[model samples]
Target: MNRRRTSRSASAEELLSTLQHLTARAREEVGLHQARVELAQALQRKMLPADLPAFPGVRTAARYAPARDGLDIGGDWYDGFLLPDGALGLAIGDVQGHDVEAAAFMGQIRIAMRAVASTVADPGEVLSRTNDLILSMDSSLFATCSFFRFDPVTRELSGARAGHVAGVWATSDGRSGITSDAGGLPLGIQSGQSYPVTRRTLDVDGAFVLLTDGVIEGPSLSIGDGLEEVRRLVSAHAGASAEELADRVLRAAGLTGHEDDAAVLVLRNEIPSREAASPDGG
Candidate 1:
């Protein structure tokens, strides 16, 4: 009996040792995963623009929110810049994933679009060329995008869509509606897909808004309802600054608990007030 008891004690010690070893390995794996996530997040932030370009009579602002339920990063991105011909170029897109690979692809797409838009004046041509470039890449990922060119002098807002959600616009007189732009397939789907351009004019004090589907779609909320909510918000807050309106859109969508990533871009045409433009307050 004494020999049997000693043998049992030895077996129990061996089992405890194995359990401790497994526990330490698991902790190490978790720490490694966390470090990787932090690094990816930093890299993703660096790819996006620090500030949107603003020009006379047009103010721009954007907001980006990452997925709340995952360790992986998302592909949603937005950009605004000046083209060679002096028009303001605005773009928003979503790559087809939520991983480190997706973030890297997002950066590549953004850069390619910028390079093409710098020389191409037409939004459709810009997307078409970018589509070809994406097809030439080694990855099989696809992306949806909306590209716009706004002429501040003429107030003409023209754009093209590539399987992207339509933008929303609100006029100074409270008229608001969703855009009806025709679109082609998402980029990288085919070799020669052509995006069509849609054109509209922005009334003074009007605003145009762009966003990714993550801002609207949720488990219980339908996309239609979400879009309607955004439309109403834009109409109601027509007087708000572009910055404030962008924030209100996110807060109204209850973005804190959203499962997917979200991004919003607001471009408002603000004519200088006579009093402000004048030397004296008249």
Candidate 2:
């Protein structure tokens, strides 16, 4: 009996030792995973635009949020800059993934789109060229994007979609709707895809919004409902500043606990009031 008790005690000690070893290993793995997540988050932040360009008569705001439930990062991105001809160029896209590769691909696509937009003024052509560039690459990844060139002076806004979510627009008089423009396949799918362009004039005080699908779709929510919710919010708060509008959209989308990354860009056409535009106060 004494020998049997001693054997059982030894076995218990061995089991405890193994459990300790496994616990330590798990902690190390968790630490490494956390470090990787931080690194990927930093890379994603670096890839995105640090600031949305500021232009007279136009107010722009952008927001990016990572998935709330994972260590991996996603590829939702947005960009705004001034074109050579004084038009405001805006873009939002999502690469197909939730890892470091997706983030890197997003950076490459953003750079390519900017380079193409610099020489190509047509929104449709810009997307086509970008598609060509992606197809030329050695990657098998695909991306969806919405590109727009807004001429503040003429109130003309031309946009093209590449399997991306359609943008929403609100007129100064409180009319709002989702864009109905036709779109082509996502980039990297085919070499000769053509993205159709949709052009409209944004009246003074009007606003346009672009966002990734993650903003509208989730585990329990359908995209259609999400879009209608966003449209209602925009219409109800059409007079809010661009920044406030962006924040409201994210908050309403429950981004704090969302499972996918999301991005949003808001552009508001603001003409100075007669009193402010007048010299010597009229």
Local distance difference test values of all predictions, in order? 0.87, 0.87
| Residue 191 alpha-carbon offset, candidate 1, angstroms | 1.1
Per-residue lDDT of candidate 2, residues 158-244 (tens digit): 999999988777767879998889999988899888888998877658778898888888876788878888888888888888999
Q: All candidates' TM-scores? A: 0.92, 0.93
Q: Give one digit per residue, the lDDT tens place, for model 1 in 1-282.
A: 999999999999999999999999999999998887777677779988999988877899998887774466789999999888889999999999887888889999999999999999999999999999988997889999999999877879899999998787887787898888899999878978788899887756878899988887788577777888898889998878999989988766573245778889999888766666556755
- Model 1 whole-model lDDT (C-alpha atoms): 0.87
CA displacement after TM-score superposition, residue 181 of candidate 1 (Å): 1.2
lDDT of 2 at 161: 91
Range of the 10 consecutive residues with the lowest summed lDDT in candidate 2: 249-258
Model 1: lDDT of residue 83 = 86
Model 1 stretches with alpha carbons more than 4 Å out: 255-257, 273-282
- Candidate 2: residue 255 lDDT (0-100): 30
